[model samples]
Target: MDDLYDFQESFSYKLVKSETTSVIPSSVRKFQINFNFSFELDVSEWILSEDDESQLVSQSHHPVVDCLVSMSSAQFSSFEESQKYMEEKLTTTSSGLSRLKSSNRRELVDYALREAGKYTAGGGAHRVLNLHFDVLLEHEYIYLRDISNYDESTRHMVPAEDSSIDHALKTVEYSLDIPEMNCSVCLESLSGDDYYREELLSMPCAHIFHGDCIKKWLRTSHYCPLCRFEIPID
Candidate 1:
């Protein structure tokens, strides 16, 4: 195991609760697994530009952590086939977690497959995982140290200007559909009648929030309420 940060692993799986049939014209069920890889890095010396006159110096930069770092999926008609495919995937080029030891890696794959097997075979597919990881990166000549509690807040966030917030709201005005999720800002539903829909706004990071709530939030913090994704600011 890599000794950069303490590795903690846990997973959750559920049947994709939809009556909608598979897109493929087959009887086999498909499973989609998404991996969430988290890393702690020491970027204090990681400067984007050396010159103060450079336009890059004025732009905001934040490490992407909440998005889908990688995705892997396969269809299996039978449990045995799925287990076999996962076992063989460990040694294949398409395996996502190839950096770990064989013994530990196999254990994870087996555990995931076993959980997946519990569901009915002909059900409407399954979704598994939101796995977390810690990685260490070292260059031959450059050595980077690890920092504790590394995040955008560690460097401080600059409050976004009115122009940027206005632009974000305008984009949402043209959107045809608002997501079913709750707004992280007001902790309320973003979907409902047309009145509620008009009150919804989405940031560039795609996190939706109530228009008034997010407008107030961006005045003090430029980070997304849910993911800490940074937005352009003064």
Candidate 2:
């Protein structure tokens, strides 16, 4: 199971605001950085049998970790000092970074610190930066078969056509029309600032997902997540 799973990680940063507060003395640079993480898992299994049509297939997705971590910058002059500071700050946090490999964690922290440093070069006494990280691990189990005797039934999922995807893109909508709900992909709440800030895509079956999440999903399959409603492929 461990060898069959693939792990992926990504990091993004946004400078929320940089202001010189009169309350805080200009001599002090109070740099604050917040970290938000969304962790997910995708599991797939296939059991082949003598009867191709009788093969058992199962797939599921759910959030594994979702949490926020924040750290306030201390006075650091050199690059090495900054790196050490970030590593210490993140190590004490309760974020998903603790679960990642030491090397992976270092890479993520290094990248984030570098990005944050870019804007803090000439910032006011108070500068706030928000960083979002996504960690995904996909696990799959399938019987090993001889390529000479390959079968089409082995391929379960089909990719949608480009035209069909375009139509779906045009159907992007918001969740404000409906009551509070969760996006099936990321498992995050809808009808809030997150969904409102970004458009949500609605399938023909009336199921809605985060625009970015559904866009990534549509790249691999045309079926609606919940109802499996097929968007016609031209």
Candidate 3:
């Protein structure tokens, strides 16, 4: 399994009700909920088997610690105002949280942006956390693919053609006119003094090799051994 994405965010305040009052008191219950939190979110990508239809992926994280803050309600004009203020903080990055380093921090930032772009994305109840929390928030977001898919990008996944490959080999063979030069594969000089002169071949990348060495390599792969340039197997 590969950790492909990390998603984490924190909300600053909670809405609590008093049992003594039939109706919860309005006004932001602002007892100075001034606390900053640092956290990590990691999601892994896995394909259980080649035969499997749906991928089994897991995202995991530790629960946020209870480092509560107390604020005076007088500081808030209204409950709605406090809620709005906390929501605004969601858009801004805190200096403390951004200073830390993580391998997946970039993926975390990308995930957050994609979620914000969605009209349906929000924090609510969902599954797959593997543990229960007092408040559970589920966010549905898409991972924007950054790389081209292998199926669409290259038709060379199949076998190479005999005529095309033979042409490439002949071009390279004709260019290397030196009577004595080293074969890159076997590290031996190809000379008029040695046999197997007819067994030499050249890739489209112009690297010279013994026909045997390259043919064996090309049997499994369709790329130039030296430069990793894709061979047009067509």
Candidate 4:
């Protein structure tokens, strides 16, 4: 029993509505449905979980906390101002906290989004890198960290510009025998009647792909999808 708590723990609280006596009528009382957040940190391995997702926001030079503290809407002043600035904002925005309901994880997330919108509207939005998701699946919980800002994309796009465009064009025009080789991207042969007339592209490394397919691929990738000859981002 003692060892089990080292890894996991659970709690239960009975939200009382009103005191009932043996002579008085009693109504079933339950806890209000409201979303709140909790977190843990290593004080080490700080960069492990954050290294990849940080780029999702397109920030280059600053640490995660640095970006959040800079947000004018977020009332955070320093790392130490945890409760006063954040709690005050959340409580003030909660106009109908007693009515909110979250019976499951998805409903909980929806409640959170509504609360966040209320908080942001009330001018108490704060930027921080510490908040993340706690997803429950199959009676287990998984932790996932995320940025507080809702506007940023969580996916990466292809780098802009291409250094070997001229060489690539020549490779497609002079070397391709469309009927004999498949476009490496869609994995469909140019010989098919469906693509007999569609434009094709080639990389300097000699890989071929449908013109439209390669165009979209290049937006998110700078290398030949097959050979990985790096296309320059200029």
TM-scores of the models, in the order given? 0.32, 0.40, 0.28, 0.30
Worst 10 residues of 2 by lDDT: 1-10
Error of 4 at 156 (Å): 8.5
How many backbone clashes does every candidate have? 0, 0, 7, 4
Instruction: Estimate the overall C-alpha local distance difference test score of candidate 1.
Output: 0.45
lDDT of 3 by residue, 1-234 (tens): 112243343322222211112232365332222323333223232222323332333333323322222223342335445444434443223212222233233333333333222311332222111111122222222222323332333322234465556655642443345443544333344443444454677777767776766676565446564455565565
Q: For this target, which candidate reaches the highest TM-score against the unseen true structure?
A: 2
Looking at candidate 4, what is the lDDT of residue 90? 30
Candidate 4 residue pairs in clash (backbone atoms < 3 Å) = 74-125, 74-126, 158-219, 158-220
* Candidate 3 deviant stretches above 4 angstroms: 1-159, 171-181, 192-198
Candidate 2 residues 1-234, lDDT tens each? 111122233433333333333353364356666666566657564544435332334577765656565556763346677677667655544333444457756776676667667656876454556666666655455543333344554343455677777676545455355334666666665454643555667776778777888877776656666555776544
Tell me the spans in candidate 4 whose CA falls farther than 4 Å from its real position. 1-157, 160-167, 171-177, 194-196
3 or 4: which has the higher lDDT?
3
lDDT per model vs. reference: 0.45, 0.56, 0.38, 0.36
RMSD of candidate 3 to the true fold? 22.4
Query: Where's the lowest-lDDT run of ten residues in candidate 1?
Result: 52-61
Q: How many steric clashes does model 2 contain? A: 0
Superposed Cα deviation of residue 36, candidate 2 (Å): 14
